[model samples]
Target: MASSQPNMERFLREWRQDALNKAQYESAIFIGDKLLAMTNDDNDAFFLAQVHFAAGNYTRAQALLAKQDLLTSNPSCRYLAAHCLIKQNNFVEALAILGEHTPTHLFATNAKRKTTRGVRAATARANSKTSSRHHDQGDDIPEEDILNRRYEASMCYLRGLCYAKQNAFDRAKEAYKDALRIDVQCFEAFSQLVKNSLMSPDEEDEFMQSLAFNSIRAPGDDPDMEDEPADYVQMLYQTQLSKYHNPQAFNTAIESLSTHYGLENNADILLAKADLLYTQCRFKDALAITESILMDDKYNFAVYPIHLACLYELRKTNVLFLIAHELADTHPDEPCTWLAVGVYYFTTGKIADARRYFSKASMMDANFGPAWIGFAHTFAAEGEHDQAVTAYSTAARLFTGTHLPQVFLGMQNHAMNNMTAAEEFLKTAYSLCKTDPLLLNEMGIVLYHQDRLKEAVKMFASALKIAAETDSDPHAWLGARTNLGHALRRLRKYDEALEEFDQVLRDGGKDAQIFCAKGLIYLDKERPEEAVQVLHEALAIHPQDPIATELLNKALEESAEAGDIGLLGTADAAFGGETSEEGGMSGDLASFEQRLGEKKFAARMKLARGRRTAAEMPGQSGGVKDKGKGVARSGRRGAVGGTRLFRGDQEGVDSMELSD
Candidate 1:
């Protein structure tokens, strides 16, 4: 009968494990109970508790596993019990279970303790070893000690989660650090620190480099792990963190994942690759990968948010609107569904509606960073700086892993003329990730405003380089080149500035701002004829472009001063100004320019201060704010109140679904 009992226990243990793997918690619980009833062993009771924990029966799990004898003997028991308490929102009790001094085990009661079978041998062997490692271990540990350390690390991870939930981020960062240092495989704890941007870029890199990943040997990563490289798990963990920085390293890690581990076709790896592309601003290429993924597995929610973002970036409005409706009808509860709806409203210039839908998406999942960004853009579009800052601040706090929130915050502060604050925020973001295209461009603008012309020039050059590398559309990054030109012009490098301007124009630059900038450089170089030519072209493209008209008038005055004649009719005709029956400009050049300047002063003031009129609000994007040929797109995170589409009414969004 005893012999039969051993076989029965073995069968039940295997059965319990199978149930756990399959998430058949009822089966796990039933098998766990049978094993406990059969042996009345502490390990069996712990197994039962684990089953209960897996099934969300926290109270039962805690009561069974938190026995003083078991908890005192096994770190796993203490961690599991504390984890159960944490789940029940009993943080105090959970912390008590974890202990104040980082104790590996906790004793709830000092009553006569009966050690579990085999624990005595395990504990003794654990005590005798001198640990060896890739780096200094300080002391040796036996096999049992290694398991205890992993469980103890889990204890720190739970503490971090508890602290984070309470908004005690500083304390949470330390706890997460401890968890990661103790067990590099504690990915959740590391992810929390990374995703929350809890650490500075330097801190993250320093800590990551310091970890003893090479020396650490998980139980599963022993010599028996013949299928993988000895350092495969550690390499994979490294790939998982620090995703916001170091593209070269990321590519190498991905290559290793594909070739070394033969995970080329792995879904998770593909998703990582796609996310990397997105971070590099290769949205179109990223979208292609995500689209292929969804075609094979349609319910891939992980790919959905990024897919929506790519569509928005590419200004695929009709496609986005159709997807929004399809997602709303089919996956109504999904955060991505509402985010798609929000993006659609955003692209169409319905700022208020976009904000509402974004809020709904956030309500569905508060961790949805894109929703928060969209919500903030709604405010930014309407020129609501304070509210936008508040929204962006929340996103910055929530999604520390991405530099995007800080980028927007910096730009918004720049818009408000808080150059000091803008620089601080932009620099902070730069430290975290120095390579984002838009981020560099915006930072360059801030530097330009601060009169740090050389710094701004470098920033713009770097931005152009990065954008040019990944940008499929030659016209995509003309703004960066424009900014470069402006910086060069400020530095009186007229020839270099003009070259940049010429490149922008060659790429089909249509923004009047670019033309005005190009014209200004010519004026700076004392070439009034060239200035007049460019400004006239700018006004021809945008008949009522105030900046172009203002610049053109100055250029015309200079040209007339240079002994030019009969230029009035040609200039007026080209610029589409009011002309007399004789087809001549009205009044003298001085009086005409004076009156024109006074008439457009309010608009120029708005332009000079970088403020948008109600009609030029951000979300009013045509084709998701393609900048309307002559209009410069707002540098805000998403389109602010751009109420009009870039295209005419003929390009109306349709309800037709996308072709599979």
Candidate 2:
């Protein structure tokens, strides 16, 4: 039986790999059950538990493991049990189980020892020029050591996942490092580490260089030429880390991975690269990859959603409908399929259809955060503010770590003129996702409206700093620069403001709004001719802009009256002139008539000031009459180049025409 153990294990391993194949689940489970019944061996339970776990029967897997003393039995039982708990979001229980069974300090020490041993083995193997057996022995880890390392790495990886879910990023980073140290090929740990912001670029490059070069180490060859196919999963992680920040580097990594592991052999890496392309808005490239994957595996549910998303974004309606129908027919019961369709509808501005599909997905799985967010988005689109707020609140609660819900909530509240509520939500969103410049821009807008000029300037400046640091999102960078110019202008910092506006123009921001801001600055400086030139440029782009038209009128008037003696009348007309129905102006005219002399102009101005003061007294009929006229005139056209609504990247919000 002891000699037969190796053969039995090899057969079991082969069978297990086949059984876990998603397409072969039912047949494999039936055969596994049959084998379990025929075997009286101590390992029968573990094998059966693996079958159940792979078949998505988490409870059954846990029950089988519960029958054994998991601490003394194969460590795999505890690892699998913890995985089941994590899948169900029972993270607290999973963490407790990991803490009880795993020794952190001991594992750390063992990891260092393993690294030392590998180095020593390599040196010894190199020294033995006569023996190939030495090389073979040097590369092999003892079975017990292999099991220990596997157990420790799995435990630490799961621990990292739990911490990440709770938004404890610092702890998550430490946990990922521990897992990588224990098992050098732990691709999951490497992927999560890159996903987090804890690693600086220099540190990430160093780590990535080491992983990519050592991905495959051969007996006696240069590290670069050609190495064995060590897992390409780590390469996927490297591409993920640089996917947005450095697309050239990401493409290079992906090409290398594809070359090492042929595209046909590594579907997950292909899908990952395709997803990265999709995120970078390279929809055509992503669609090509997804199409290729579909040709080989039509029922690959994961690839179908991505294919549809690419199709929708690319406006490939003919293919999009075909794929959507196929996906619905193939995976009708899967909530994610419904969620994907809903998100597609949402993206396309079909709110009614989006809501219907989102609701269906929510009914299928109440915990699905994207479906709930989709539902909230529909409510927001329809201007049902209260309902939208409620739905967004639910989404925020469900997906605590994601910034989308809070960002949308802040935008919605800000749109509705609820500045206090908007700022609160934006602050929470900033806390959740500090690196997003868009959130900072929104916060700055809120502060700008609240009359906190200094605070708004700081917010915009901070957003600009982050945008420059990231250097990937051009829209965020340009928008923040524009907002910074506006903030500086409000603070009366003309020189700094002009520099910002000029920088934006140099960076290809030939926007009508930027021109209007610059023109306003010239108007404030009384440089009417310069103002006229700038305003004409703004009007050429946006003729209906009310504020630009008003400023242009003022500039024209100032230019015409370049040396006018009727400055008093011009000033009075510019600042709310007297209404013909009111008697205040008649009283002022009578006083001016009474002061006729050589110094009549100066004396009439003094008497006009007294009459104006008398007319503006509290509770006076003249004041009441003036207030009524001002209120009546100040209607829809009152907001002259006033605060712009915070329209995020979403479409349809800027539909209102800019007019008086």
Candidate 2 weakest lDDT stretch, 10 residues? 632-641
- Per candidate, the number of residue pairs that clash is 20, 0
**Cα distance off (Å), candidate 2, residue 117:** 25
The TM-scores, one per candidate, come to 0.76, 0.60
The residue-by-residue lDDT of candidate 1 on 1-660, one tens digit each, is 886988888888999999899999999998788788778898888888888887889998888775536888888998898888888888888878787564423111112112211011211323433433232352256777777778878888898877776767678888887887777667788766654556554565667665545444434635433223324654465444444445555566677667756778776577666665555456678678878888888877656666666676677889888888999889998977887788787767777888899899878866555677777777777778799889888877765545666766776776677889988988887876676666676677777667687897898898778755643344656666776776676566778878988897888876666677777656545567888988888888898877677778888776775555543335433243454422123434435445554655544355646744323332222111222111100000111000000111101110000000
Candidate 1 all-Cα RMSD: 11.4
Query: What are the Cα lDDT values of the candidates?
Result: 0.62, 0.55
User: On residues 573-638, what C-alpha lDDT tens digit does candidate 2 reach at each position?
Assistant: 333334232112223222322332223345434643453321121111110111100000000000
Which number leads on TM-score?
A: 1
lDDT at 220 for candidate 1?
61
Candidate 2 ranges with C-alpha deviation above 4 Å: 1-39, 52-72, 78-102, 109-141, 148-236, 241-325, 362-372, 384-406, 416-434, 452-478, 493-515, 537-543, 563-660
TM-score of 1: 0.76
Identify the runs in model 1 with alpha carbons over 4 angstroms from their true place: 1-4, 11-24, 67-69, 103-141, 216-230, 242-244, 329-333, 399-402, 451-455, 465-474, 523-526, 549-601, 604-660
